[model samples]
Target: MEPQWVPSAADIAGARVTDFATFVTARTGESFPDYQSLWQWSVDNVAGFWGALWDYFELGERSGAVLVSTEMPGTKWFPAQQLNYVEQVVRQARTDRPAILGVDEDGSVIELSWAELLGGTAAFARALRELGVGRGDRVAGYLPNIPHAVIAFLATASIGAVWSACGQDYSAQAALDRLGQLEPKVLVTADGYRFGGKTHDKTADIAALRAGLPSLAVTVLVSRIGGTLPDVLAWDELLAAPGGQIDIAPVDFEHPLWVLYSSGTTGKPKGIVHGHGGVLLEHLKAVALQSDIGRDDTFFWYTSPSWMMWNFQVAGLLTGATIVTYDGSPSTPTPDALWAIAARTGATVVGTSPGYVLACAKAGVVPRRDHDLSALRMVGITGSSLPPSSSLWLRDNVGEHIPVASISGGTDVVSAFIGGVRTVPVWPGELSAPYLGVALDAWDEKGHPVRGAVGELVITKPMPSMPVRFWDDEDGSRYHDAYFDMYPGVWRHGDWITVNDHGSITVHGRSDSTLNRHGIRMGSADIYQVVEALPEVAEALVLGIELPEGRYWMPLFVVPAAGVELTDEVKARINTAIRAEVSPRHVPDEIITAPGIPHTRTGKKLEVPLKKLFQGAELSRVVAPTAVDDPALLTWYAQHTPPN
Candidate 1:
């Protein structure tokens, strides 16, 4: 848990975080002895700290008060702010620089310059207007991770229309479940998408989505795979609407900018809405300063349109950084595809899931020796409890000089709460520091602050990017119950965390799925660390089912590597590994080898849903097909699983 990689003098000198420290020192005339001290000061003076961040990014003009409310769910900031999220993001865009670079699974790349982006957004916005999509209207996208999704979002936000997007890979019902709630007036889709060297046409899925949403007045199709829909406007036609240029709409401070869905594991996904002023300020700090993305950087994070990282990638443009996206399996064709993208694009900050990094390690991928990745200055990681070994492996196999950021946060806030800080050294298996102005803490079950022990991750103070309101949840009943129910006057984020004495935090999976063995609790990450470390296992999932009469059935499902058989020896190795690395109390009652583990489209283990399914919860109530990678895998689980 110590610092795995130390920042060089040049690295520290050039970091935007260091620059912010100097800026804060000059403004407040307070000496932040270190990054830790600066973070403490930021949380302590939340209002002044955020105001300085807004000033640092120069996100937008401020005429009124900076601090308004600090209460949970109702905390308001930037009282008189009048601006647009798209405007702040694309303000520095110019014709000279390439604004977006996208790569698909079929080895195709799409690059758009600033002028093309601006002109396309303008045309698209005009097209939306021509279709009667006006201010406060909803425009949803059942799209892939591509430049078109970005353009559609920019265009929708440009005209003050709220934007929401579902991944193209989502099943028809899942897509309907999410987009149906928003009742978008306009829907955007592509003919299909390619992943893992396979093509999937989403034409039928798109039709199904349109059928379920009665409010849709227009459906625009991007012939990404080269096909025309019967009654839809082509992507090219939308761009040829004869509009002059992008017209940024300056709405009120609290105007709804976009809607993101909660990862509805046990029930229908909640449509979490965020505003322009708040996200603008929060994303500015999270991206520009904490992540050190700027004009000189080409940033890439392998993410789908459904995940919050997609929104974060788009936020990269707020600092004039070139946004690069890859719409394919991270390990397509070979285990080196992600690293190949980094090398080919000359990406300055290469962000991906720890799953990908761990895959490279398991597959013996040494991109530093095999590929030219000299331009990769930082490896930004997230989407799970990043094992310390993965961080060290990335440094050894990719680039030793590169800093590896093991970060955490969630879709609840579109920005990271604990993640990158350029001023701090890359600590193994830990986040750098609390994101500036995020009042984060570790709380016991009774809501007591605790250190060096696992506790619930709670946010004591309101954040600018916290969900303004859940769509259709009038009277704020559901909103309060979603976050504040567990901890009075605080946001219980539902994840178990440990803030150590070393000024870093480690996320111990979701608290709901915490494993209990004879009154001893074990984080799933602990079992995962032991099982996946074995060469035979590729991925693993653990769940403890409690029954009456003090009985428990703990199952460990593992997806073995190709060509590996599920022999007794393999099971013995797994059980022994868990007993050795963790404790005997953590060993599973059974080790089942499965073909694959079901992951959310965003690549999180479907642990809670599967647990519910085992406990006799209805499939529809337990799992949303739209939220998962393969519904077929779940059917297999349901059929093969024994009754409790």
Candidate 2:
């Protein structure tokens, strides 16, 4: 593939990765002639690279060894350091710049200065303390992507309490399924949220969620859309309280910072816990070095509280860059809503999903021509594979000079393993390089490394940001089984990837059965739980298929009851149940009547095989007839044409 864009001489000279290379050379007397060599050195000498980062970033006194072990699930990094993520963020606060810029769907803007953000965090931290939220306690947020969510998260982290959140778009049952596992002490919520030019009242959902969580001692309401709830504390009152200087509680390197949920493919979502020091160091390396964001940049990513990108966007504050949060649909009144916000906020780096970019291309919305994008320097795409045409369209429409960086990572680490580097050329439909300190490789089924062909994505070495533990997994059984069951000691991320000889990577869609729709990951079990509840539905199967040109097709197959027929009314009822119970995004594109749903002999749904069949793969290549419960149903599913 030819290069779509290349960095200028000034970009290479001014990049933080280049500066870090020079620093490494000065410290260890090792010369790295290029980005690939630097990455190679970083992976080969993991301890030295991490130790140098600790000193280069001036992260407080490092006492213990940088790496304790090399085992995958048991590997430990910085075993003796005590640090806080909020404290690192506080060090970058400046009086001259705004710490946060919040925008709503109606074009209202809210700016929080560094002093105000610090005050809000202090006051909320005091309130949490008064409510008996101590170290290791969980604080859950049922809120939107507003500044209050950030303030509440900071306050929770400031007190050494673990934070977890679900966006308002999630239903009461869905939210409870994830947050109920935490047994949190406090719940922060809002009355309503706006999306797609409509106001969604979450008051009833909040009441149900609060009722289900018997462990909640306090409920704080933000009053975003204005409603009253009995026995709830007001957000305004919490921030209005007189607060002194912020108190950042020092925590050990392995202390849990926050809990993020997986898609719950098998059952209930898994609570993945990341530590304080690990997140601090990893985000500093990711945000500062790979993305080339710094003090003068305004980082904006269209994200909600449910996605990992929200956390990644908040890490911009750790790098002294301004962060912007949007609390509505990316495309409401126009296709260029995000672009307009970028223009208004003077965003230097803008992150979005491939679906949004393809929509812009389809709508004939030229961002650089319609908006004042003079400040824009880069466009980032993630959450799914970026088609080559979409990447080229971004280069043509957004700006020829702006690099289109397509990053691939997941909620497991909360950071990218392969992403962009400002010094490297941008190739369409491919990521520039594997991140420094990440021993990433493509391996065949037999564990041999492969190049220029699709294979399982594996990480050979341990990253600082790998989860400390699963929330309730005391024996570490679930944690070990999740990543190590397939490759033994290697971390096998459930994605197929092709690593070229040039060290660039092209990510195919997921190899697992997890459903990814519009960049938000949902479990097929979630849909089945809702759809199969109807009396007319006997059995159900759902598939989220990724097609060419950045299109997604999700279809629900249902087996009707003995006396019932599959009709439009039943389909409407199924769709309504899924939307009201699970999530609107998981609503299937089509509902079809099936003679029976195929499953394995062990009773697990054959989701991955059926998904590949609909994606145009042959049945012989995707599945074996002897392994299925019914071979006839597989043929039935393969005969149906996929949606355009």
TM per model? 0.82, 0.99
Instruction: List ranges where model 2 is wrong by over 4 Å.
Output: none
lDDT of 2 by residue, 229-271 (tens): 9999999988897667889999988799999999988889999
Candidate 1 lDDT (Cα, 0 to 1)? 0.81
- Residue 628's lDDT within candidate 2 is 94
List lDDT for all candidates, in order. 0.81, 0.92
lDDT of 1 at 43: 87
Per-residue alpha-carbon lDDT of model 1 for 1-644, expressed as tens digits? 45877877787789888899999999999998778888889989888888888888776566777767777768777777788888876677766668998888767778888888888988999888889989999999999898999999999999999999977766666677778998899999999888878777778778878889999898999987775567898888778755566888988767998888775543567888888888888888888888888888899988878778899889988888898977778789898898888888888998887656766787988999988887888888776667677778887888778888766777778878888777787787788778888889999978899999988899998888888899999899988998899988999987778997877888765556756443233457656756888999999888876533224578989899989998998899888877644445578889887878999998889888887677666888888888889888988788656435
Clashes of each: 0, 0
The TM-score, computed over Cα atoms with residue i paired to residue i, of candidate 2 is: 0.99
For candidate 2, what's the RMSD?
1.0
